[model samples]
Target chain A: MNKKYNLAVVGTNFIVPRFIDAAERSGYFHLHSIVSRKTQSGLCFRSANGYDSDVVIHENIADMLNDDKVDVVYLASPNAIHFPQAAACIKAGKHVIVEKPMTSNTRELLSLIALAKANNVLLMDAMKSLLCPNFSILVDNLSRVGRIRQCTSTYSKISSRYQGYLDGNNPNTFNRMLSNGSVMDLGVYCIHPFVHLFGSPEQVHAYADLLDSGVDAAGIVILKYPQFHVNITHSKTCATTNSSEIQGEDGTIVIDNISTLTSLKFVDKKGEETEISAPQDPNSIFYIAQHLGETISSGLKESAVNTHALSTKVLTVLDEVRRQTGVRFPADDR
Target chain B: MNKKYNLAVVGTNFIVPRFIDAAERSGYFHLHSIVSRKTQSGLCFRSANGYDSDVVIHENIADMLNDDKVDVVYLASPNAIHFPQAAACIKAGKHVIVEKPMTSNTRELLSLIALAKANNVLLMDAMKSLLCPNFSILVDNLSRVGRIRQCTSTYSKISSRYQGYLDGNNPNTFNRMLSNGSVMDLGVYCIHPFVHLFGSPEQVHAYADLLDSGVDAAGIVILKYPQFHVNITHSKTCATTNSSEIQGEDGTIVIDNISTLTSLKFVDKKGEETEISAPQDPNSIFYIAQHLGETISSGLKESAVNTHALSTKVLTVLDEVRRQTGVRFPADDR
Candidate 1:
């Protein structure tokens, strides 16, 4: 029999409901609790989702972590508080899945990894791209393109909150204090695939257009591998069709919406295209939920797909990019 | 009546025949003379292209220029010799059209500009992209995409000469002494359109994958404008569909092939794509030939479309790219 673990979720953002629904539908987990700064919002989220009366709502993260019934906590709060919230969950001996830009920087991520091991709890970032079935297929079919020379991956869309920011409001997505910026919120989606597919580049150079709030509005990063180059362009101030291409010696692979792995096709030397086939889910978050659920069921310390090592390397690159772009968060010093 | 100028061509490469056909078809110029290192090749080129027997063939460049009937000289020689050949034409008091990467460096370009003035003749580089009818449409439609935040333009084709280079032969295209590299050849196509569209960028950064011959096999260049970023990725080592995009605050412009401007469309915030329509020619080179003939007939000393000032800015940026990539030619020193 497949054991369904009890899952607690933090925050009440759009992503939170999606995560909760995916987690329960994967048949490996159920919504066990909710944590939010506002008690009313947590209750509203649980009621709206029809999670029943047993789903506990905690206004305090510490009080939420004290619940032994919660086997794993998913952190989806603002970019700033992921570290402290995940650390409290880990110290309480519950497995934790922190959302992307896993923590403020490499320092906080490393600390969480250590604390998770000390408390004998699993730790993983919600890096769902790698867990998606299409990622493996994309990597497997890369040879069809011959010796790769370059990959251009991009994800850029104006945030719903951007208009407010332009109207002289300080949204958390553009707040320097919250460790929120384009590189963190959007660029990470572009970076992880390169790291997963090509490994760490020999050199990383980045140029960013910073908002007046001292956060990146948009940026271009050039990652120079020994044999090729990978360019990552991400923005919260602009939008694109977001198609990407991988150039190779004999052919090219065209990927539609790389962040989603929407559709992929390879054009050979003769310019004939071969459609790459792979299984895809409407909500990719479900794959990560299943992977984490399976990991917790097997008593594993971390997810194999979203490994600690991968997160560490990604965060290190993120730190280097921030250094190059001159974006430092108050959380980084913490 | 518009005067059809008498034109002479030096070298008998593939582009030479194409230029001859376009120049004549445009009804603005007729082949007047031919000069080549080998007399037979020049004679063969004229014969194969079906030029009249009166189209004079000269083994010596000096002999070709001495023909008073030859009003303008079109240089189609190896890149390294463009400087010397163009200078000789300008010194001989004849209008001249040199191919792209006008000279090895900015110094040579500036010198030729001054020399053309002193010699009282028209001087121009055959930069075809700006002359193409579609380019004007692209520039004019920029507002539909809103304020541009980024542009990724690439032109990479695995050259037929690459196999020879891999088979341990030094093709002039990969030869260091010939001022030949991917940037000077293929990358030039990607750079010119950006300079024409956005003017010059404030900063340039580049990375190259160099061949054993000490020339770039492939490269990525970052051009940082004050408000946006432009990325140019070009290679002779690899091939791609070579589609590109201009990302803007409200929309994106998708280009099928930037080097050719084969197709373009604007995707708005609602994701509705509007196909951008413009005049396109099967042989796009005809546009440049017609413009050059018209410029000479108008008694202009230089091209307004492919201005010397634009060429200067482009060459300056190219020099910076080479500096960053550590690609230098023996011709640059000369």
Candidate 2:
């Protein structure tokens, strides 16, 4: 009999359908349950994908994690809820995959990691970015640049919602209590990629433009490594950028888009450049599914790509950035 | 008889010869004196292009400004001295043309502006970018895209001297106390073009990558206006970037090099791009010299290209950015 791991997906919204699609295509995992904060979201999740009725639907984390049929918990909730939901899953003996900006702050994430380890549960930060084939290629090829002198990464999206925020119509994204600004949202993407390439920085300095609600609408952060430095910036109320560029002693490596896996190029100091492309995956969730399957099947304690420790480090940087900029979410307070 | 204005040029480094060349070429202004802080620099200034001994050499600002032979003060000193020099010139009944980052801070500039107004003397920020013919063309054609939306400007130079700073050479260009860093050095070039075209930003937020000595090695900042935003970035100890881009409601105006004032293009919403290359002058200093001649001849109270208030505004923003990033220049205390 082919072993089928039962997977439970939580918080069905902008990303949930894609996750479900990838899970369905994987065939290694059985899509078992869908959980949302409300019944309508669960129905929307089901209707959007025409999901099988065999899958359970739960409105609350306690009910969902308590269900024995669910072996893996994927908490793709709001910026504020990742920690509590993931901890609850770990306590209930389910492997956890929480979305990026894993917890509102470092302290919350540390507590969750402690609980997960104590319970012997596999906890991953669902940062599929580090797991992408293209990213792996870039990291492998980074040494071609000889020695990295500096790197600059930018991720900016022109949010229609920001226009609404300015008009006082919709303000959740601008709200400090939701951790719904550019740094926590987009800048987090820049942080992990740089951290994955060059370990935690020796010194970190950030300058964020605060919104009316005291959250960062846009921000730039510098991570000073031993040999070089990484300059990262993100803005919710702006438009596109050249993703990320790593400049070194010999050449430069540029990734067109960091938010999603895309193309990259290595340009040598002599101006010789080589392009590296990723085998296209229609759904962004493919990497996460593959990582989870490999981690479980190989009996590996955890996938190094999204290890708990790396998540903790990223969370620590986030905590310091928030402290410096004075951005806070309810979960951070918790 | 053609009215001739007498000018005193300060600082004898890279830009002094260019200013002297322009002044000598112009029939409107006669180079009266060349003041150098060091005797060696004064001799170098005299030997350059065979400048005559009649050009008075003063070692100090008080002596240069007090000299009745000098009618206008052309300051090319390090960033730290621009404020005091301009203030002293305004006090001494001479017009002033101080180099970029007009002063270290806004308060110093405000005081100078008051003094200039009281003395009925012309004061201008000698920004080559604002008066460039190519920039004027860009500004005139910017509104063709209807209403403006977004902009990204970058001015970066890979300074071998910054490497010297890393080697602990302590060059004035990398000096933290002189307000010398990537942003002030390069980003001021980026800001002049953007601000001249789009006008002052309603809000400004900066993200600076501070070097070991507390200078911004590289940084990115966003200038928020009413309808859209402008992104400005620079790095002295890093790679380079394109000059500037102004995106509008219908299209985007991309300038190949704002500093050089080279090629330009208008890309519309449907992706039709119209490239327009402006006539380039081998010597980029011609535009400023022409402006200086016209402004002085017409007895204009302020320069149209580089106005006093606009220069003051830019200095104020730089001050706030330094304050937030803890970039305390030696001049700040003075």
Candidate 3:
């Protein structure tokens, strides 16, 4: 607690500033710098996040890394650039936090993890759900349902940018080059909690509604295990009841929302329902940032929560989904 | 309305009595005879369904077929015997109503339809969902959801007999010899409406959790259409919220129960929700019986609602599901 880690954030996407805010509020991190592709964007991101005159601004990763004060680099850039940027930070011996879907494919993710290990820097995926306390509550209550029979995790919501894509405009969300399809953007949330709770499945069967741009508008990915089946339903072009469920022989667990573990309950065979308390904290990133700061202080080389192995399995499922559905990405296999 | 057709009812399963009551209530059919493998069971079913002493009880299909007064034969027998039994009735010039999942596989269904055509008799599947007033209400409101993007229909319920099977007893529900399983017993309800509303998809990807008895306990079938995707999620090992949903570019239609369709509503992008009126009738067979009686009275050889084409498509999807999941049946390919 006596020593605060200096943090520098890249990318001015909406999530970046919010992550920085949470990181600073955790009190283990001081926002030392802001990095952006353009000078004005860096300033805008700085002021929008309420950074005063003392916060340094850098136009490039090289400039930020050259000044060694940034003890941890948070890469929240577009998916295509995540690997290269995270690699640069790890090579510079700075602890790294790569945003959800740490890389476009398994190969890239594994390569980045190897690089982080070679450099002895703490590397982790900013998959917040597992790091949050509510997720633990859900996992802990899994035994009440008896033997698992099947589970379904759905994270389908109409994206704000979909209207533009329909109106003859190209949105990054529907673009294959950015690796921002429904599965990558929303389905990863489904895959993580699913794989984390029940390890990797024995097989995967997947299908997606491909946009003209070759990215999935929506999709269903079924994971097959020896004892049960898990269905991960994700979409960007539509909205649904969007609750995730775990079905068992004796009862069922219903999760109100997936990305944010808002509230969960168990309904036994006799139809008795008990609500399990879960924080409705709108900011999932705050939990991830706190966990990341603690890990950095603890001097770990990788996150024990969002382990490299968990991220690998999640991206492995994503890889199979894109393979089956033909949602190709530029960063795939690179 | 004055001419009540003599209806011969087969199968003593729980759904059989409900169907008989509905058929009699429709006022277009009079219970003439009851058929079962056992004489006491046939008499028991006849008395339990309120059939008078004058209503004859037969212990075999041939005796029921031989009764010249039997105007129509309703086959609710085990799935494996549906095709053979329906063929016997159609050949005897009796109008026929085959229960949901008219046959074990697509091939058997097609063969029975062709035989019915040659015999010049009315033959139809009693897929009650398409025949119900609530289903019509749902179809009428489909346009309110805008251009469809994805749809998911789930029909999952733990069977009452599941406990007996789990306790080292081989219940008929989990038996492959009788062509009984979760997908056949429950998932057919999910697929019938999905195929009816959206037609057959261009491709299919299916998976199931197979029991030691070589039948599915739970499964998912993904139907891929050019414009959208339809997921037919079904189970019998567990229970779920079990709602059906249609996602469109602008809105979504949510059906509370798929088979019975207790209620439905449309929720638009603006979060404005409108409830669609649908009868909460537990007896879906009532609608099917009323429609079947009307169709037979109209002298139609096939149901205009649960058309030959719809049944063919539905059975085809079920076939693929069983094939993919390795849940084979004694009635398959016959």
Candidate 4:
């Protein structure tokens, strides 16, 4: 139980509180600092989340990276800023954990991976679902289902800020300039698990309902594999059943809440039900933080579970889906 | 009620028994004749359904169509035989009810509509789902949900005979030569209701897992409209949840089985449930039979509920999906 790393978190959005909670729960990582553009809001957020009064608070990335005590930086900034922010952390010799979508495009992600290797610092995508203990249980039970035939995953919830957008507000989640859209914001949850379960698809096809803001409000992506096919539907404009199903020749697996993966049920041909449950922390970020801490302690440059290769494959597929659906972001030009 | 129209059935497949039962329940249609390549199977089918012994049995379509007493013909033949058989019945001045995926392509369906008009005989595509009394209730309750945002319909069931195909027996349901595939055989149930609920989509995009038989074993079609989007997924290789959902700004409508539409539940944003139930006849085909008989008695050349126009629209979308998926039929050349 060598829990002795100093971790700093970037971004003050809704995810900052969860990341702080994850760090505190890991028991191996200390919340050494936080970087936010508004120092007042940063101080308020730190106190609200019960961070120690002595925790360093910085208003910019440079100031936080200069802190020699910070060994790991968890980046949860906007989509367009992920590459530059993570590159800066790695260049400063700090391990990094990025949010769901590592970067806006595959080229940026590839370059970041190269830079991390050059700097000899670990770079990992904080895809919490893959890091959960239950996900390994699912992977272990895949053989019981026999030959896979089809998979359908859906993640849709009407955004609370959607009404504001409809009333003519420019929220970051719906802004193309920020590299934000339904695919990047919501569909990433589906793509990560898909890539983790099955490797890169042979072909990718997608269709979307693009909003006037130049971002997709809803979309469906079809991933064609050699033996099986996957269909992922996601939206920010409406809520759905939010259930995922994988059908095989001998049995089927039904997963509720693919993002959290709280419940899994397997049904065989004889209609026998088997419930597989695992330890689920109230805060999902705790699992990813624990895994990241352990991997860093062992001197690993990437996660064995949320592998760099898997993140790259997911980003590549998402890039293609965005291109096919005409969801262009400012970062795409670069 | 006329209760006197003479009805003739073509094809001795499993659906013929259901058509016989529906006619018996309609009370307006009498089973006067049956057409089959082998009259022995037709006799057995008639006897199994308890049809009167005096019912005429014909070995050819011409003989049944020429019978002056036959007022309507129900063509339940394979996918490729629908157009020619329905056209012949129309030319013989008998009303016709053709099973779904009425023909292999839209061109044949359009020609049938025109011929039925010229002959002054009622022509209809027997899509029982559209004619179900519960369907009308759903249509009437659409406004309660507010402006529509998205709809998802799935009708996937592993065909009972799929094992035969897997074992190297080419059943008609899985045979490309007979113009039979998952989309044509099972997807029509989803497409028909989609068109009935929302008119023809502006664009249709599809991806499929084509079997070695040159037909799709499973596939998904995305229908894009101006205000809303629809996703229809159908498969013959496996069974699914078999549910349909329509999401709107204020509420959602869910149907247990889109094919039979036995249960409908509406949920609002406040988590209130409204169970809307309608008259659900045990025999679904009875609704279509009753509608067709009444429309013909009124001297209408097409059904208002299952209109020739609506049928053509659905087939046109189906044709586009087939073209995208490369599920070609011999009749497609014509």
Candidate with top TM-score is 1
Error of 2 at A245 (Å): 3.1
Score candidate 4 by DockQ.
0.45
Off by over 4 Å in 2: A24-27, A36-67, A141-150, A160-179, A198-216, A222-230, A247-251, A267-282, B1-123, B133-153, B160-184, B190-233, B242-284, B309-334
lDDT (tens digit, per residue) of candidate 1 on B1-334: 5677899998898888889889988898888999988889878888888899999999988999888888999998888888888999988889999988889899999999999999989999897888887777788888987777778878888888988998998998899898999999989888888988878988898888898898998888888899888878889987766467888878888877776687888888778898895758777788889899888888899999899999999999999999988999997776
Candidate maximizing DockQ: 3
lDDT of 4 by residue, B1-334 (tens): 5657898999888888888778867777888998988989878987887889999999999999878999999999998899889999999998889988888888999898899889998888888887788887888888877767778888777777778988999888888988899888888888888887778988998878888999888888888888777888888876665368887767778887887889888877555888996758888888888888788778888888888788889999989999998989999886
Docking class of 2: incorrect
The lDDT per prediction is 0.86, 0.75, 0.86, 0.85
**Chain A TM per prediction:** 0.97, 0.94, 0.97, 0.97
Taking the tens digit of each residue's C-alpha lDDT, what string does model 1 give over A148-191? Answer: 87788888888888878988989888999999999999889888
Query: Deviation in angstroms for B79 in model 1?
Result: 0.9
Off by over 4 Å in 4: A268-274, A277-279, B270-273
- True interface contacts reproduced, per candidate: 0.53, 0.06, 0.66, 0.26
User: Model 1's lDDT to the true fold?
Assistant: 0.86
Instruction: List candidate 1 segments past 4 Å from native.
Output: none
| Per-residue lDDT of B95 in model 1 | 94
Clashes of each: 0, 2, 0, 1
Local lDDT at A34 for model 3: 84
Q: Which pairs of residues collide in model 1?
A: none
Query: Distance (Å) between predicted and true CA of A178, model 3?
Result: 2.1
Displacement of residue A269 (Cα, Å) in model 3 is 2.3
Q: Which ten-residue region of model 4 chain A has the weakest summed lDDT?
A: A241-250
